[model samples]
Target: MSKPLVSVVVISYNHEAFIKQTLDSLLSQKTDFEYEVVVGEDKSTDDTLAICKSYGDKINLIFSEENVGMIPNFIRTLKAAKGKYIAVCEGDDYWIDPLKLQKQVDFLEANPNYTICWTDYSIVNDKGELTKTDFGYTKDIIDIDFNNLFTPYSTYTLTSMFRMEAFDLELYQTLKHYKDNSLYVLLLREGKGAFLNFVSSVYRVHEGGVYSLTSNYHKNYSSYLNIKEIMEAVPESRSKNMKRILNSLGNATAFGLLKQKQKGEVLTEDQLKFMTDYFKNGNLKTKLKYFKRRFLK
Candidate 1:
């Protein structure tokens, strides 16, 4: 086959019911440029492999002999991508618009200053029923600076398409957890991000999702450490601002670990110190909350 302009990396594991729909959605994309679908099937014990095989040479399929975890699978899939742009849609999610690829590619081609382009998406349940619409924060096409990417504004993974060469592979290897956020931050460092302000994909929330299986403390702690690591890896010029954001996020996560301790979870000594320092420097309301959580119990 000829070289592809964009490569769609589809990471799959045991999605017997949803794989067909996901593949079909990708195959249906109406784009003027060439694109390839690279499917990473991570040794599913179910019929997912068989179903993917039915597609034959329609997709570039990579079958894992053993079940590698999601991060490994994603890294492998990303390495196999042979395109100028990389668009990701997990196995459980699917696109809603046929012109999704065309629109994103057009925007990226016109705006060389942007590193990533993403659109609004709708949230769907396991049954594929729409739960929430308009998931992105932007109201019009706009550039999101690096600082904005660090904020709590929600971005949809299913709707994001980014330049393949925007990431630093060496720095990416050091990020041990929080793939989505880490990737976003790394890409934003290359250039500004673009928000298209239109719904193009659907995100499925189910019991098997990462958020459903992981505890809040684990997630928060991982984010706290990952953010600190990323901040340190950034250029020295940006260190001061990144450190400020780190303190805010770190203290909040430390406070979360404290809250989880009442349920018999153990926290590290450094975590305790972080919480204490945060309360000491915080306003009266934050100090009150800290005291209430610690002594009132």
Candidate 2:
């Protein structure tokens, strides 16, 4: 068959409970451009593939015999993408606004220099209900400058879109599991990106889901290291003051590790230095102010 208009890659592994909602959400998009749904069912023991097959001509699916995990499966599914631009919506996540795809497409078409775009997302309970959590990541939308990307923000893959060339093979090989942040960094490093501001998707938080179990404080440190490493690889990135931003992140993580006794997680000299140098270089007044609020009675 001829190339499809848009490639919407959806990764699923044992998301049988929520896959239907995700599919329905994609089928309801209000874009003027044509699009195809590419499903990578990564060895789900559940009925995820069976459900996908039920859609037949309406959707395209790829079922694997072995689980390739999140990053590998995501990269694998993109091989089938026939659209000039690729959009992503994970298995458990669903888009709330039907105009989500249309908005992103319009922005990319109008701005050729920008290769990436994303909107804000809201958190939802397991029963498909919105939570008290925030829907906007004002930190990112306000300014997507390189420094902004380094700082922690509300950005998530469910609300983001990237052009096909967002990552090169060399970069992808270097960054394996941290695909989400890697893609964000690559786009920010190369071209301008837009923050749609509108809350276009619902990021579901099941009691048994990912964010609920993963330690946020721990992940932040590792992510900071990855960003530092990538910056070092890109010579032009030095102009963005990437090193200072990473140093600040290390300082923040040092305090975080101190609170949880995670300094033990510092396995090597590099990890130890990341914590110590930041601590030694930390501003005295700032440190004192922090201790006053945190320790003083």
Candidate 3:
């Protein structure tokens, strides 16, 4: 086939049960332009490799001899993409709308100022039953930039399509943990982002899911680390927003540990040190609030 206009990166591991559905959704996209599915099979011990191979030349499959974890696999798959635009749909997630890629590409083509575009999505169970509809937002968020990218709004990876030129491969490689949030911040640094009104994908919440299955502490700590990395990755001019995000993450981590301590969980030395440093570097308001939460209440 000729060179694709868009490249969809699908990272798969032991997702034997859901890989087929994920591939089918991507293969079913009815786009006017050519797009390739670049599958990064991380040496799955299950039937995921066989399942992906069954698609033949329909997808550009890259299987590793040994597992190299998620972030590395993602980076390598991105490196393999030859399209002008790039999209991500992990093996456990599936797109619901057949015109998902078309809509995103149309927006990016028309709006050169925007670096990335993402739509809303639904939450599905392991059985593929819908648990929630329109899971992201009720309205459109059209003016997302680096200054306001770290808000509570959701930008699911499966529903996003971004300009390949906006990606900073060197910066991404430097990050120890490259989460979706990290990618959003990296791309937004180049330009702005857009949140479409319609839901176009289904995010599966199953036992095997990475972030979904992690504990509250692990989730909070992981977010903190991701934000910290983002702060270091961006330019110093963007430090104000990154610092604010880091402070919020620190608050969440500290308060979460405090809650766990109240429930008989012992705080680790590292956790204690984090709380101490968080308060030490915090502003007056943060100190006052922590004082009230710690001493008065």
Query: Could you estimate the TM-score for every candidate?
Result: 0.86, 0.80, 0.92
Instruction: Report the C-alpha lDDT of model 2 over 6-51, residue by residue, as the tens digit.
Output: 6889998888999999999998998777888899888888888898
- Top candidate when judged by TM-score against the true structure: 3
Model 2 clashing residue pairs (backbone): none
Candidate 1's error at 243, in angstroms? 5.3
Mark the regions of model 1 whose C-alpha exceeds 4 Å error after superposition: 133-138, 150-152, 236-245, 263-292
The digit string of per-residue lDDT tens for model 1 on 1-297 reads 799999999999988888999999999999888999999999998999999999999999988689988888888898999999999999989998999999999999999989998887878886757965634464678676655654545567788899989977777876766557677778888888988887788888888776645876666667767776776676532544455666666667768867767778776887777666767887776678778888998
Model 1 reaches what TM-score against the true structure?
A: 0.86
Please list the residue runs of candidate 2 whose C-alpha ends up more than 4 Å from where it truly belongs after superposition.
Answer: 132-143, 150-152, 238-245, 262-297
Clash pairs of candidate 3?
none
Error of 3 at 236 (Å): 6.7
Displacement of the residue 15 alpha carbon in candidate 3, Å? 0.4
lDDT of 3 by residue, 1-297 (tens): 789999999999999999999999999999999999999999998999999999999999998799999888998899999999999999999998999999999999999999998888889887768965533455665577766665655678988999999988887888886789888888888888998878899999999988888997788788888888776777632656667877777788887777777688878899878878888788898888878888896
Better of 1 and 3 by lDDT: 3
